[model samples]
Target chain A: MTEDKKSVCKPTVFEELYKKHSKDVFNFMFYKTGSKANAEDLLQEAFVKLWKNCEKVAYEKAKSFLFTVSSNLFLNEKKHEKVVHKYIENQNKSSYKDNDTPENVLRQKEFQDKLNNAIASLSEKQREVFLMSRIDKKKYAEIAETLGISVKAVEKRMHNALVILRDKIGKI
Target chain B: MKTEDNIENKDIFLAKWIAGEISDSELKKLVSEEDFNVFQEIKNQSEHLSVPNFDTDKNFSAIKQKLETPKKKSKVIPLWMYAAAASVVIMISFFLFKTSSTVIQTSFGEQRIVMLADSSEVILNAKSKLTYQPELWKFERKLKLEGEGYFKVKKGSTFTVETENGSVTVLGTQFDVNTSDDFFKVVCYEGKVSVKQQNKEVILTQSDAYQNIQNEITTWNSKNEAPTWINGEISFEKTPLKIVFESLEKQFDISIENKTSSNKLFTGTLSNTNLELALQTLTSAMQLKYTISGKNITITE
Candidate 1:
């Protein structure tokens, strides 16, 4: 058990992989899900999946697996949230509450709300792709690989998310 | 990039537009020269969406902490998922917990589903508050509610979902209890849930009903009821203007600035639409001019 694990068991390899990719993985998830809590959950789940399948998993392919699992799980959670309207209180120092505008930030409060709704309203997968692209700032190649779809599909969802947002918020 | 490329390239046009990198030819492709002016109006609204105030480290940590409990399979859901949520490896370095003594509170439209140490799950509604003595309740799982929550209590010998106005005692059942402004409603989705309102106890059995909303219980008595938000389904039931705004806020995690809200109530059944289309329905229905300003939805007369 001891001597052969180093021969085939690659925890050392996995540790190195975690060090290299966990940040990007977590960031991608955080941006996609729009909740730190959901992001963290996805991040851990991705790694756990990788660990369980470590025998067939390669370091290079790990990134793809993590992102794929993350995207799917986040989408699943969004789809079946179970609890309705579960708010986290005392949880944030909300970056900007001041709604400065032509009206001097009067609508600032409403702005964040609209953004949240806009994102939430998006098809969970589309929202994920958009957040990962813009907020996590992921590249098309990385996203395409992780999503197990063509770059064209990723771009399409990203495009649809934007269109829906523009149309929804644009009229308001 | 072919004959019917418009269907495919339509998304590309949007992507390029969002990046502010659209070409002249593509710009023309989006809208004809005549409608270009009007299309831009909608496009202007479309570009207003963006992620905000995201601190990756802090957020990841908060998620990690909530999910840090030991892996226990007390229900149908597999425990593998929770383990994936709070692994120490993925645990971010920074997290901010609530400083307030209030154990349960929601901001704006945020909802929380909490599984107590005993494995009962509760869904807290928007702008609600729940305060319970966390300690000194080892023998019996005790908590107080001041807002709306749907509880799925794990089978415990003495289990109760209590509130300021009333309390619901349970022998392991599922129910939704909404207690606010001295009005209380308890709807049992599963099992037997009894309501106690000051020396009066009424048991709510499942038959598709709503309890104590604005001082009346609306019972459809159909087994299939609408728990829209839980499934990310937007069900707008010809509600009032203010309440509609409130629903929008809850659904989007955003708000609207109403200098003065209208008294007119709306009645319609709206089931799934993309977020924008849904909001657009409001603007069109109200005939109000709305300017989408980067996460902010500003409406003017």
Candidate 2:
């Protein structure tokens, strides 16, 4: 049944793969670099590369293939210059409707910034796995499958990331 | 919290807690009450934290455009570059034959204002070359422009600026003429100016703009009384990214290797003084990204 499926080279099939995987892949890159602009650049490069090599990449393997390609691209970029990891926060103020006092809002914003810095301070490996699990809500097994790592490794990274973040953020 | 359990077991337990596999009472049993609250808050806010929203459709179109843009001919010069070089060479050789002509050229990031013998003023933009014969100027006001120049011609019989693409003639008025390979633009600020390109002739009055991009003629009303470049700002109105990159290259004296085939149009203004701010302005607006290594820059989407 898998062999009878359409080739990934077909525009329709390739586009389907893009729509399905591009967002996650972009988030994956964003989590790694902590910069949306860099992530967008790397995302475009990975998809274009996938299109160029569609003959070899099957539809089922496209997501992992993109992840691997983008990861490698990010690494190569890192070798040339120190990648600045500034996570620009877009204010999602409406989500916290519990108390709308001015002081409470300022305190929340301060806490958010500190939390962002703590996350950015984590090791690249720990940060990616942790964000993939917490932010993207991916399972350990799914994250393992995409990163080509074992589930045990994913769990270890996630746990370490939490411990480090908790220590850095301290109280609240 | 058991002493007999190893680190791996704790890893699995925390992972399960994060995945919501463990009940809150059970999680509290593993950690202090304060720890439980912090852990719960971390989990909740981390989920709430959002990165920039990635537009799938827009990026897919950008990717499709990149894939379609021809990449095999990396060694060959692009058509616009070829046209620009040829036009400059032709303009230079035409001047080389004139022994009594005066030529004024501005290097990269340099602009110059020259007062003609006829008391007319000409402001040359960066990387521009202007040539005129003083002897012939008394009989007929004619000059050649290799790049971009704004002319304030003295009221006379006919003042002409010859370019590779076409010629602009004015009788004592202010106007700007810009020419490159397959691109010609004439903006009139005051008085009447007649633009001739191939077989097409257009007359532009005050606040009139005429542009021919690959034989496609478009005319629009001007907004400003003078070119903004004189004020140290480069402005574009629905201009292609290619032209924007070229202008940046000329202004910053840098070579930009554009790696994408994105035909996105941009309408904005950029400062000529600061390269970093200019690149940020252009890339962020175009929804693209760039990396600068040494003097070379690469733009991608």
Candidate 3:
């Protein structure tokens, strides 16, 4: 938002944009395409496109621009994508430490795996909204803005994604 | 019915819960305890999920490298694609060249100077037709000729002039070829040429002439620098009277009837551009009288 970051043509400002949004953009592409390599490629391509049109893109609008561009790039590609799973890192130990039985640990791990699969199997739209809200800790309004969708749509996807995950794990 | 009502309102309450707009008491008012518990677990578990590592610095430099050499980035079109395109173009042009031939024809009493693709010159005589392929001329300098033509070939590949009776082949030369019914003659005025007739080839040099008239082949020498026809005069050496009359007919676009049918061979030069002068010269030399009547002429010995 500063005057220094106004011109994304500058290397420093461009890098600033890249650093701020590259992870989120990369994650968004990963959630859509379900391939890390594809995500990385789209990430690079989106930033490169941004750099090409740096003079025109305002710094505040760059994040949504990157998301829109990355999503469009993913859509332009062939739709035969593998289901996304197993990118989930370990959970915080605080919740599990109190009930640290070996059977409890194994059950938690199983639940987590099922949860990951259920999330991955969600429709690409729902998974995108859910993860952006939960993993990125983005608000529904922020998710809707980044995704160029209505806040109501984001919340609906989030709720539907939770319902699917709960169904998959089935009362555990 | 109460559970059905709660299920319908679940979207609103869940949206409120996820947005942190509703506390537990408010969420518990809309949904069953078990459903709220499941939603909480799904959210908590999802919070732990994250995308794989992306090295920001490494990719930034990659993008920087791409931007730095903006001109070098091109579509990943394979080399075989270019090769395939080139082959297609070559094939199309080859077929076009094979199927397409240019024929240059000069009507009666008409003379045309055709400059070939290789800059070779062909001065087509009256009632002559020349056919060649311009695309294939670069590799092969060959053409079919009917009637008479004077060729000034440039130095390159072997140039060939094909006629019904014989063909004349030369590396580079200036020559004159005249072919009609039962008469084929090639006169070389510069450089060297090989005249082939009925399984026999005879090479000729400056001012050398070869003739095959009525199946009798002979070689003669000429004293002129070039073909005399090019200078508005048609010259011949011991040519048959039938062929001479035919030549006059072609040049003047007039039918000549030689009533004498004389077997004597004619040797003379006649003005081709002037019908009266040419008739006078030919008839006087042949010791004959000629009368003309509107595109028709009669000769009596």
Candidate 4:
């Protein structure tokens, strides 16, 4: 297993993997925890862990490893925080809204709030697949690899997530 | 349009659209559908979701720096490798120091004073050369000399001067040794010196001189404290005319051509400071005529 990993995990190969997947992993973490600081911290921790185990982890499995490590970390953090504490904490921080007219700003803020609440309402599996597909701009094949599911399963979960988000957020 | 089949088909289309795999016609067809606006709105908003600003260059540089620093548990060089490297350095330094032995030479008509590693002094005559190993001087006072030199040895261990013809060994004394082609001479000034030629050994004390001419060994007494040539005078005692002319050539930086036989012996002194007067003195004493052209002197009888 070590020799198999060493054949694939060269430094240049690892760097290419980091470039290909880091932003997606960061977005996956950010949407999962809904906190930029926590997402950044988890992103660094995931890659550092990848480097530490670089010789043991195969290059092709790097994406799955990053997503799995990041999601587990997010789940562990979620188990420690009370729902009320999470709500209050999210309420204190405003999601990024572009500068516009007063009415536009209010409308964008309302839509962002509804979007966040809609996302928060999703099942863990559905949300993970949806975000990996949508926000990370990953293909169904990549989403399936990361979530350890079939491509058809990834599509089904992503479709369910979109339907649920559309219902919660209402019309545009 | 609101049928279950239509809903399933729309979900597949929406997934394709979000994955950016939808063809242009497929996208146009989807946009014209009734529920397309909702899915498009979700897709647009999701794409615009803000992520944390990650400075990848900065983070990668930090990682690179961490990897470059030698870790405490990194593989240590093997002991034999360190020993090999040390031996290589030792060999290089040994060769560098050994080849730094002192070598002194004087051109024709040029004289110099040399101070050895042990503070001993030597007055080297014209066309002389001397060499000694400075690192081994204290343990063994040995030197190699060519041509002639006057040595004022400091009282120490046995001082040995080697020449092409023979070797001279002394304890602590002043002496002069002249080693030229087929001729070797040693004159002791203040102390004793031992001369070895082939199987023969000769020792000389103060004012004692030993000369080897054409395989013949001769001894004589000197009235002066040093060789006369050192004081701007060239003196010879039963020396061949050929040797006398060779000395003149060395002392005056001239080339002498003897067209006639020069087997006769010469025993006289000539002033070394004046070329013309020295030539006159030598020629008149030998009843030989000579002519000088530039630096060349021709002798004829």
The estimated TM-scores of all candidates read: 0.38, 0.52, 0.48, 0.43
Report the lDDT tens digits of candidate 1 across residue range B1-301: 2447667577666655545556546666666664444345434432343433445456444433333332342222322232212100000001113321226555555666566667666655555555544433457676666555556677867667666566777777666665444345556666666666658767666633334434453443424342443434433333356656655665466668865456565654332335577667777777766776666777766
DockQ ranking of the models: 3, 2, 4, 1
Question: What is candidate 1's CAPRI-style docking category based on DockQ?
Answer: incorrect
**lDDT string, candidate 3, B3-84, tens digits:** 6746665675576676677677777776678877877776666666767778888888667645533333211122222211
Q: Every prediction's TM-score for the first chain?
A: 0.69, 0.88, 0.89, 0.69
Best by lDDT: 2
Ten contiguous residues with the weakest lDDT in model 1 chain A:
A83-92
DockQ of each: 0.11, 0.34, 0.35, 0.13
Give candidate 2's TM-score.
Answer: 0.52
**Two-way lDDT contest, 1 vs 4, winner:** 4
Q: List the residue pairs that clash in candidate 2.
A: none
Of the candidates numbered 3 and 4, which has the greater TM-score value?
A: 3
What's the best-to-worst order under lDDT?
2, 3, 4, 1
Q: What share of the true interface contacts does each candidate keep?
A: 0.21, 0.55, 0.66, 0.29
Separately for all candidates shown, the number of backbone clashes (residues 3 or more apart, or on different chains) is 29, 0, 0, 0
Using DockQ as the yardstick, the better of models 2 and 4 is: 2
In the range A71-128, model 2's lDDT, one tens digit per residue, is 9999988821555665545366654777678887776677777778888889999988
State interface RMSD in Å for all models: 7.2, 2.0, 2.0, 5.7
Cα lDDT of model 4 by residue, B3-118, tens digit:
55455666565566667766544655645553566666666566666444667776665454344222332221212222111000000000111132456666777666666666
lDDT of 3 at A11: 70
